[model samples]
Target chain A: IDAVCTAHGLSVAEFHALRARATEAKTRAYCPYSNFRVGAALLARAGEGEGESGGRYVLGANVENASYPVTTCAERVALGTAVVEGLHSGNGRGFRAIAVSTDAEGPASPCGMCRQFIREFCELSMPILMFDKNDTFIVMTLGELLPLSFGPDNMGVKDPAKP
Target chain B: IDAVCTAHGLSVAEFHALRARATEAKTRAYCPYSNFRVGAALLARAGEGEGESGGRYVLGANVENASYPVTTCAERVALGTAVVEGLHSGNGRGFRAIAVSTDAEGPASPCGMCRQFIREFCELSMPILMFDKNDTFIVMTLGELLPLSFGPDNMGVKDPAKP
Candidate 1:
């Protein structure tokens, strides 16, 4: 807990709040296919964790479909909302950090696609906190989840060039 | 157009129907945030594209949220559904191909993250068809997009243990 808190430049209480929010969000997920409930929360630069009103947003459990190829994981749902909101707000800075939790026996890791997208905004060292129902938690950096991953930059996309 | 038909083992007319369905699914897209609606259709097996109902399924657009940290791209939405349906049907085989279309200007490609997940279910040579307005199109295999990717084989995970 202390390590996760320090890594995000957050207080222990703030980090706990983030995890709690993720747990709550998991309940609202629409995952009828996998029955794998996941929840996530993001701390925007100007988000609630920063003591701001609208900067931080929370997203909860979403589902994947039987179409196999059509499923969306919980982590990407949270990140995409942040990106869309950031674009709409006219300040394209995406989420500064994210937290995810699942009801699985062990911590559910973010999918590979999400790991790549997370790198698009947060640096490799950006903190991603994950927790399981057992109260077991692991905090990792996006870079660690995907070593040498590709992002928008690799496609010649820069922040200023994004739509 | 010809390449897409050939890749999916479909006739030109059949591929057009899938693309049309993909185009129509865009209408139901929940991209209230981005307003850049997208949709997808999958040709499940070799015989499906030819209208034999060869296990093909259709999926549409769903967006992600910043607070959620998991975004369900239209393509992923369609493909994930295919995965579950395959298992439930006891086919045990994954989707053979997927096609995606979006309202964004020019041809928009799947993000790196989606590519990784797509590779998880299909072989390296699995075809992904992308199309844009004006009949502009591009074709590529999973290998072309992900190049060298990591999958269950890399993690010592056997097919029986895969979800």
Candidate 2:
């Protein structure tokens, strides 16, 4: 936990809160198809005086459709909610970190589609925290997870919140 | 148009409206990445006393992410919105038909992921209407679009709305 806190600049409290909130969000998932519930929480970059845990956080749970392909993973749902709320366009940098919790025995990482989605709003160095049911976890930077990634910069598209 | 109307049990006006609405929704897309715009409209089944066009219609425009795979196709976006609106849990059938419009030369088909997503909420015979830039179109049933598809049934799962 100390290593994670140090590596990501998150206080121990912030890390614990992220885990609790992400686990809570997992319960709200609509996944009759997969019976696999995944929850995600994002820590948005905060303003000047806000302390480590003071940043705005948004939660998202997997919303599955009967058609499996239609399933919106926990990661994309969180990011989509962020975009709709105008968080992506905010100052102080876009996203600081994202954490995901799932009921799987082993840590489950973001899928290809979600990795792409993260590439949109997060810097390559942004950390993604994955937690399994047992609280065992693994962490990977966005850059390490998706090498040679394509981003909005590729198309000369700046921030999504900008016109 | 006449054949589509006759074959699909839709009146001429319904067909025209689906095409027009889908085309209009295309204008709302946020695709700075691919510059590939797609719009989709679903004709939900109305309750007994509803008018021909009275069934609620849901519109979706492709919302892109910097990561290409994270980019949701227009079809899934519309369907996801429907799920969030409590429309999927309605007494009437979830959706009767889906129409997609794009600026591509020939009609654009829904992607493989979208085809899988469509399989969940629609019946095998559900028709998918594809419209190109010139207002030209082609119609195919969901079963035809995705052959031997996998769905909730495959996983012993059921209604997306049901807990």
Candidate 3:
């Protein structure tokens, strides 16, 4: 736990708080069809505040379509929400961390598209924490999921260069 | 135009042609990473020793994954190719009759969880087609897309007859 906090430059208390939010969000998952509910929460850098919460974007499970093909995963829904919110905020800062929770037997991992979309939007070093029902977790970097990925560079789209 | 056939009741020529060769599948969609690409061929069905060709099964594209969360759009890719082949097969299965496509514009119209999966395995119906580049499509059936939709009554799990 300490190592995870240190790697992400997050204080111990702050990391715990993010995990709590993720757990709460998990209950909101709309998975009546698959019965595989998932939840995600995104934490942004401190200092940007408009509402009671500052620099934090929380996303709950939202299943949009009945046709399986049209269904969006919890992680993507959350990420999309965060991206839209972040863009509107105009801070130009990427997410600092993301926490995920699932009810699978072991740790439930995100699908391939979720990781790609997350990697595309965040920095290589962004911290991602995946927790199982038992509260045990596997913490890693977004880059670990997608090594040598095709990103903005391939598309020739300029990302706001990292400061 | 002579290879494919479809039928609401009469077995449209174009869709029927592709339904014969359901074996020896097409491209393997190795989507261990999120680079969704797939290619499929809707074969024309033929009678045993009769040399009758009018059945088809569409092939799929390759959808990749950088990580587990993001995966390829196999359903759309296969569906698209099927639609293209259906039109050219010209056995008389119209394009607009198809409901799903396996392409890249949006999420592939199929997922592992839906009833379409059951339709794919059962071989209950004929003239299966998928969509092409445009929102249009090829011919196909519920059995082609879904092998066994969760049948609540099959396992004696739910007795709708009594309730």
Best by DockQ: 2
**Which candidate, 2 or 3, would have the higher lDDT against the true structure?**
2
CAPRI tier for the interface of model 3: incorrect
* Candidate 3, residue B58: how far the Cα is off, in Å: 4.4
Candidate number with greatest lDDT: 2
DockQ of each: 0.12, 0.26, 0.09
Runs of candidate 3 exceeding 4 Å displacement: A47-53, A62-64, A87-89, B1-163
Q: Could you report the Cα RMSD, in angstroms, for every candidate shown?
A: 9.7, 6.3, 13.5
Question: What lDDT score is found at residue B102 in candidate 3?
Answer: 40
Q: In model 1, where do residues sit more than 4 Å from their true spots? A: A47-55, A87-93, A160-163, B1-163
Alpha carbon lDDT at A42, candidate 3:
77
Q: Could you give candidate 2's per-residue lDDT for residues A48-152 as a string of tens digits?
A: 466655478877778776555567987776666555444565455478789999999988999888888888778888889999999899989999999997777
Q: Predictions ranked by TM-score, top down?
A: 2, 3, 1
For candidate 1, the TM-score is: 0.51
lDDT of each: 0.66, 0.78, 0.56
Interface RMSD, every prediction, one decimal place: 6.5, 3.5, 7.4
